[model samples]
Target: MGRSLDILLFIVCLAIITPTLNANKLESSEYWKEQRPEFDSYWQEKAEIAKQDNHAAYFPDPYAVSGNFTASISEIITLKSSRRNLKGGKGEKCLATNPVDRCWRCDPNWAKNRQKLADCVQGFGRNTRGGKGGPIYVVTDPSDNELLDPKPGTLRHAVTRNGPLWIIFARSMLITLQQELIMTSNKTIDGRGVDVYIANGAGFTIQFVKNIIIHGIKIYNIQVRQGGMIIDSESHFGLRTRSDGDGISIFGSNNIWIDHVSMRNCTDGLIDAIMGSTAITISNSHFTDHNEVMLFGASDSYPEDKIMQITLAFNHFGKRLVQRMPRARFGFIHCVNNDYTHWEMYAIGGSMNPTIISEGNRFIGPENKFIGKDQINAKQITKREYADAKHWSSWQWRSINDEFLNGAFFVNSGPELKNRPFSRKDMIKAKPGSYVGRLTRYSGILVCRVGQPC
Candidate 1:
C-alpha cells in the first residue's frame, strides 16, 4: 500500500511539472480526409436514425397504432412487455432487472454463447453487432511494452486487429497502458468472468472507427499520454498526437456500446464522443468522483455534431460528481431510467438546440452542506448554459415521469412531446423512476464466475 501511494504521488508530481499535451485530434492530422472519407455518408445515416428516435422511442402510446416500425423496434417492444422479475429458486440471487440485462444476464453459459449479447442492445445503438461472427482472441498478457508494434496476446494487439475480433482475458489482470489504445473497426472487449482494470495510465481512443462493444471492466485514474509512433492497425503504424486522457474517447465512430464499466478520477471526462460521432449507447455503467462526466459534442462551433445521436440509459451517477452528468450540444440524447444518487452541482445541462429526452430517472439531491444558509437553487437538477429562458425554452428538452427527492427538481422546457401522436406500431415504454433502484441494483462491472450467471 505504501509503495502504491508513493507511486501515485510521484505520478502527480510528474503531471504538475510536465508540459500539457493535447488529446488526439484526428481533424488536425493530415491523414484525416484520406483515412475517413466515409464520414459524410455515415453521418447522414446516423442523423436519419436520430431523427426517427425523437419522441415515440421515449414514451410510446399504448393506444396509438401504425405499422411503420422496424424489426429492431419490434424487438424492443417485445422485450419491454415481457420483463418478468425472475425469482432465484433454491437461494440463488438472479436479478436481471432491465430489458438489456434480461437479454443476456443470468445465463450460466454466457462464456460459451458470448455472441448472444450481440442481439441485446437497445435504443439508438440497437443495431450494433460487435464482433458477433468473429474469432475469439484471448489476452494473456497485460503489459503495454510495444507501443508501435504490440505483442500478441495483449489487449493492445487484440483491439488493433483487422476485420472483426471478440477479445477476452485469460485471467484477472491490471493493464496500465503507456499510451492510448487506438482501436480498429469491429471489436468487442469482453471482460466478464474476471476482473480487468485499465488504470493509472492512458485509456481508450475509438478514433474514426465503427462497431465496438466494451463491457464488464473498470477504468479509472487515467492520465494524459505524450504523442509518439503508434501502431493503430495490422498494416499501419504512424506518429500520433498526444491523447487527452479520457477514460474512453469515441471520436468519429459509429454503432458503439459501452456497458457495465466502472470509472472514476480521470484527468478528463470519463466518456467523450465528439467530432460527429453518432449511433452510440452508454448503459449499465457506474461513474463517480469526476467532473465533466460525459460530453456528447465537442464544441458549439462544431455544428457537424448535429448528426450525433446517443442513448444514456440505466446508469448510476454516484457520489462526488460535480457536473455534466452529460453536458451536450447539437445532438439528440435519450437519457432514460438512470439513478442519480448525488450531485454537488446540476445533474444534466446542455447548450445549442439539441433534443434531450430525459425520462424515468431518479435524482436524489446532495445533502445540505452549507453552514448558515442554503445555496440558491442548490437542488436545481437542470442547467441551460449561456442561454436565456427565451431561446432554450423552445429547445426540445422535456422531462417525463422522473422522480426527484431531497429538493431536487428538473426545470424542463420545450414541448411535452409524449403527447405526440404515435405513428410507429412498435415501441418500448419507459418504466417509472420508482423502479430505478431495482433496475440499477447490479450496475457497473459484474462479478462473474465461469459456470455461474453474470
Candidate 2:
C-alpha cells in the first residue's frame, strides 16, 4: 500500500514539474548558443503573464451574444436567397461590410495615414499597437544572403533593427529566406501598396518577442531550414537549431496581429502559436492546401498555455485543408465570423480541454463520399482526441450562430453557458455566419495603389 502511494506521488510530482522543464529546455539547447539577456527567466515570466490575462476582460462568451446573434442571422437570411454571397467591386463607394474592413478600407488616404490601421484590431489583441509610433522603412532589397549582418534594404534588417518600424515593400517581390527569420519587438511588416511574398524556402519565427503586426503578405510553400549562426536582432545573433517550417511560428510572444495574409502548402503548420503566446488576432487572412493549419499552446502536457487567448476572425479556410484548423489546447479561442469551406478530417479539434467559443462562423463539411451518411458524428466539426467522452464532457465548447452546411455539425458539451463567465454589460456580438461570405471575400493578399482605395 505504501509503495503504491509513493508511485502515485511520484507521478503527480512529474506532472507538476514537466511543463516548466520543457518550456525552459530551449535555454539549455542549441537554439540560443549565445544566451539572450534574461532568456532563462523569459518563459516563466510569459507563462505567468498569460495566467494573469483575464479572458473575461476581452473574449466575449458566445452565449452572452446569442440573442443578438440569432437576430442578425434571421435578418441576413431575409435579405436575399440562402446562398447569398456579397462581394466588393471597384465601384464608387467602398462597401466595406465587415467591421475590420470598414475601420480602414473605405478611406481613400490609406497610404498617407498608414498607422491608422494599427487602431483597427479587435478581440484579444486589442492592445497590440504594432509599429504605430514608428518610422516607415521601405524594403528595396529582396535577398537573404547576409546571415550574420543583413543588408540595409533587406527584410531581415528591417525586422531586426531593434525598434518600432512600419516596414513596407518597394514593389511586388518574393523573399525566399535562407533560415527562420527571427525578429525583434514592436515591428510591423506591412505589404500594402504591392505584393510581398515569403515563399519557396524558410518562413518566420516570432520567438520571445512582443507587439508585431504582419499584414498583406503571401506566405506559401514553406520548407524546413537547417539552422545556423544567424543574426536575429540588431544586438543579438545566435546559433539557431533546425526550424519547424511553419509559415508563422509564434512562440512565447504576445500582442500579435496577422491580418490579410495568404498562407498555403507549408511543411509544418501554416500558423502555430505555441508556448505562452497570447493576445493575438489572426484576422482577414486566407489559408488553403495545408494539412495542419494551426496549433495553439505548446503541448498537451504544458498547461502554461492556459493563458493563450487568440481571435480568429474574418478569415477563410479554403480548399484542401486536412485538419487542425487550429487544434487548440488550454486557452480561450474566439473563432468569430470566419469561413471554413474545406476540411478533410475535422475542422476544430484539441486534446487538453480548450475553452473554444465558436461564434457566427460558416463551416461546410467534407464532400459526401468522405463519410458514411448514416453516422451521426461522421460530419461532426469538433474533434477531441480523448477516446472517453467523460474526459471532456464538461469542457466549455459551445457554438452560437454558427452555420453548418453540407451535414456539418458541432457537438457542444459542458454546463449551461448562458450565464457566461463575464458580465452581460461586457458582452459584444459578432456578425452572424450569413455575413461570412462578404466578410471573408477579400481574405488573402490585396493589391493597393498609392491614392486609390484598396
Candidate 3:
C-alpha cells in the first residue's frame, strides 16, 4: 500500500514538473526569424489613415463643387488675344484663332476649367465623343513580325501623341514589347482583335489613372515555358504589400473597367487592385496558376476608402490552383458571379475587418477532394486570420453561415464522380492508409489531399 501511494505521489510530482519545465523552455525560446514589427506598425498606422480617407470619400468636402465646369470657345479666343502666335486677329476670326495651332492662352477662368476644356477637346476633337468621354486607340504591335524589346517610355511614346484613346489592331502579328504599359486618365485600351502584347517584360502595371478600359486581348505565355517574367513578383514599401506584380495590377485609380482578358501562370493574383480604387468592374476573364487569384484593397493606408465597393462578375476561376482564391483583408468587397473549380484550399478568406459580400459564385474542389469542413488549409492558415467563423466563406454569405452552422459544402456529387471518389475505395477498404485521404468515407467527411486518391 505504501509503495502504491509513493508511486501516485511521484506521478503527481511529474505532472507538476512537466508544465514547469515547458514554461521555462517557452520563456527562453528563440524566435524562428525576427518579426517584421516595423512593417506591421507601418501598415497599422496606414490602416488608421485609410479609415480617415474612407470617411472623406463617403462625405466629401461640401465646399468643393461636385461637377467640373467648361470654358466657352469665346473665352478661349479672348485669352488667345494675349498670345503672340495666332494665325488670325482676335475678334471675328477669334473663333478660328486656333488655340492648338501655336501659342494660345485662355482666360483665368479657363485655368479652373482646364480639365473640362481638355475633356471637350480630347473627347470631341475628331474623336467623336459627342460631348462625353472619348476613346484613345491602343498602339498596336508594329506590323513587322519582329518583337520589339519594351523599354522605359515605350508606353509614353506610343500614347503621348495619341488622343481619347481606344485600342486598334493595326495587324494580326505576334509582337511582344518588353515594358510596362501605363495609361493616363480618360483612356480606353480596346484591344479589338490586336495582339499588342508584352512578351518578355516583368509585368503590366497601371496606376493613378481613371476612366480606363482594358478589353479583348489574349495575354499569356507571359511567364514563358522556362524563365519567369519580371511582373510575377513585386513589393511596396507602403502598408498595401503583397505580390505586387499580379497578372494585371490596377492601383490608386478610380472607375476602372477590365474585361475579356485571359491571364494564367502568374505568381501573384491574376488581377489585383489596392488603395482608393473604386467602382471597378472585372468580368468575363479566366484566372489560374497563382497564389492569389484576385486581391482588392490591400494595405492599411486606404482603410477609410473602404475597398468594399467592387464588382467581380462572370469570371471563370479554373483548376490546378494551390493558392487561396482571395484573401480579403477588410470589409466592403463584393465577390460575385464567378465559377471556381480544382481548388484545394478555401476559395475565399479574410480577417479583422467586416462587410464582405460574397454571392452567386461556385466553389468546386478537386475531383477526388470533397468538402471536409476543415478550414481551407487548416494546416497553413494562421490563427489570427480567423477572429470568427464568419471570416471564412464557401460561396455566398448564406453558405458561409450554413457551413459554419451545419458543415455544408457547395461542391458536386453523384454518378459523374462514381469511378473517382474522394478516397481510393480498394486501398482503404481493407486498411486505411495514413495519407492525406485516409478512408473511403471517413464518417462522410471529405478532405483535400495532394497525391493519388486516398
lDDT of 2 by residue, 1-454 (tens): 6556655565455445332112222213443443343243544554355444433323444334333433343344355334233332344366555666666776768898999999888767767888889999999999999998999999999999988999988899999999989888789999988989899899998877788999999999888787888887787776766776789998878889999999998877789887778888898999988777898875666786777888888899998777777888888887888999998668998878888888889998887441122222337899998546988998888887789899899999877555657554444455667778987888988877776667
For residues 330-383, what per-residue lDDT tens digits would candidate 3 score against the true structure? Answer: 534444435555453456655445334334344444433222332222222111
Ranking of predictions according to TM-score = 1, 2, 3
> RMSD, each candidate, Å?
8.2, 8.9, 22.3
lDDT of 1 at 402: 83
Q: Which whole-number lDDT from 0 to 100 does residue 45 have in model 2?
A: 59
Write down the worst ten-residue block by lDDT for model 3.
61-70
lDDT for model 3, please. 0.39
Cα lDDT of candidate 2 equals: 0.76
| TM-score, per-candidate, Cα-based | 0.82, 0.82, 0.49
Tens-digit per-residue lDDT, 1-454, candidate 1: 6556655565455345432223323323443534343334544554455434322232232212111112322344345445454533344566777778877876767888898998888767766888889999999999999988899999999998998999999999999999989898779999999999999999998877778999999999999788677788887766666677789998767888998999998888889888778778888999988866887786767887777778888899997787788888888887888999977668888899887877778999887553223222458888898899989999888777788999898888887664556533343345667878877888899998776666
**What is the C-alpha local distance difference test score of each model?**
0.76, 0.76, 0.39
Candidate 2 has a TM-score of 0.82
Each prediction's total of clashing residue pairs, residues at least 3 apart in sequence or on different chains, is: 1, 0, 26
